[model samples]
Target chain A: MKNATITALNHAMATRQPVAFAKNLSDGTEFLLPDPHAPEALNEAGRLALAADKSTTHVLGSESWFIEARNPAPRLVLVGAVHIAQALAPLASMSGFEVILIDPRQGFGNQERFPGANLVNDWPDEALNQLKPDMRTAVVTLTHDPKLDDPALDRALHSNAFYIGALGSRKTHAARLERLSALGHQAESLQRIRGPVGLDIGSVTTPEIALSIIAEIVAVRRGGSLGLRVK
Target chain B: MIDVEDVLSIAASWHGAGEQVAIATVTETWGSSPRPAGSRMAVTTSGKMAGSVSGGCIEGAVAETAQQVMASGVPKLLSFGVTNERAWEVGLACGGKVQVFVEPLI
Candidate 1:
């Protein structure tokens, strides 16, 4: 039954148009139009069909279709342009992500310091306005300063950004929560945050810390808790 | 402009399209070179390519070698030495040595 659905979807996607499955070879053939707003299963069919036949298939609105075909390159937005961010940005960029480094501190968030990076020297709220954080966005705040880190976390927790983490020690994280709570951020939203963010891999140096943070983000995005430790 | 990944993607794309392509890579470099070794330029039997192995100094020579490899269906390594006094004639400005691997990509 599942295979049938997938096959039907594939058939639809291939025509570069939409297609319908003959519930039975007896029901007669029907070509269904693909819904642009269809679910993943439906879109998967559309993509599979396109891949199958290169000829005899005329794609309509191909410009729009190609635009849709280009998957949104997920962004790993770092709110602090610190050393860890400097290292993490390049590594993430190489891994096929559009990395954005935002810091209001001019000295830290300049192009010279992070060549090939989309550097934004603006406050988190203002930056988030221009670069909207959707579910595809993963945000990490490493300012280590409450003033800089808190506002970013506030905005991130409310946005659809998938991964939201803040860097600091346990004590600092606790203090940060108090500040957020005082600012009226809901506890449930705060719960979504990964504090002292990163895999529990005794990371002490700047690079190691960056690795741990990146690993944790990957774990969350993959929908796995591989780094969780049993006390 | 052909960036590093764009070059790699073109190579992969050509291979996927079932074209015979040879990739010549500069694995090392020295002295006032525009591109380092490990830089790659791919040449297809039909003469389409992405990337550059040398700063354009030895590209013609490499292109010739690439065509030979495609015709013969064999991969080989070719090198150019800029240390030779007449190296400037070939295109190397400062004395440098470049190792190029010409292999038919599957």
Candidate 2:
């Protein structure tokens, strides 16, 4: 690996832009992906590796190249500092997510209550706007009140966040969807939310619910199936 | 060359300082390998090392190979573990096998 390759890959990572480093094992040739100068064959292989979010070996005829995908760290934005948020924040962090808890209320969003989380003291919409949730982000609205959860969900719906979850019952989710519909969110986009958020593991306690939520987030991120249990 | 943690930026800083450096990455693993693929370790000419390709099983040999790679400006793919034919060549008595790619940071 040349210092030039390391510098370019580091630059891409520092900028939080996804990049793939391709190395030809047989010839010791190295190149960065998304480079117009690189051969089209390697570029396509890099594209596939990045899209799959993994490091893989691609063979073209007799040449084999290792494509290492380096994407920005995944982030989990908790829109309410409720009980579930307290339980879920650390779990998300353990699961390799940069957990951020957003709540304007000082008492709820304080560092003492939720340790090891980036706390946002602004309203959910403002916080989400400033945070600029991207494709690597997972957003969850833990406050059941429409005043708090609705705006957060609205902002999340507009962003490129890969996972959007809300803490509520099935009936609560129906009403929440109706309110979002009134705000002009199309039905198709609204379907992206995993309401009554979390997989169906018959969770009854706060911790169990939090576990279910994290499991569901992991399931979505890994492209795993929930079958009928999610309903 | 040293087994520890993921320190890519640190390696870049060393390269910026004009130090000869080499990086080794665990590209493949079999059976009960201590570290999974993508684990990395960086070594400098001054013997400074960080990160681990395994749970310290083959870092010493990798560090030595990294210095050679830095000197030669060439890359090498090394395999270790009891399963490999030359497993004892590097002192990886562990049961699983791991392939590490070592290259100079030129």
- lDDT by residue (A1-231, candidate 1, tens digit) is 122333444443434332422111111112222445444454554466434411111133221111012224568989989999887987777655678888999999888888878889899878877787887689899889887888888888779998888888889998999999998988888877788788888998988888888787767766677645333
- The local lDDT score (0 to 100) that residue B14 gets in candidate 2 is 91
Candidate 1: deviation at residue A101, Å? 0.6
The lDDT, on a scale of 0 to 1, for candidate 2 is 0.83
Clash pairs for candidate 2? A3-B106, B3-B51, B4-B51, B4-B52, B5-B51
Residue B6's C-alpha lDDT in candidate 2?
42
For candidate 2, give the lDDT of residue B16: 93
lDDT of 2 by residue, B20-63 (tens): 88988887777878876667889999999988888886899999
For residue A162, what is the lDDT in candidate 1?
A: 85
Error of 2 at A228 (Å): 7.8
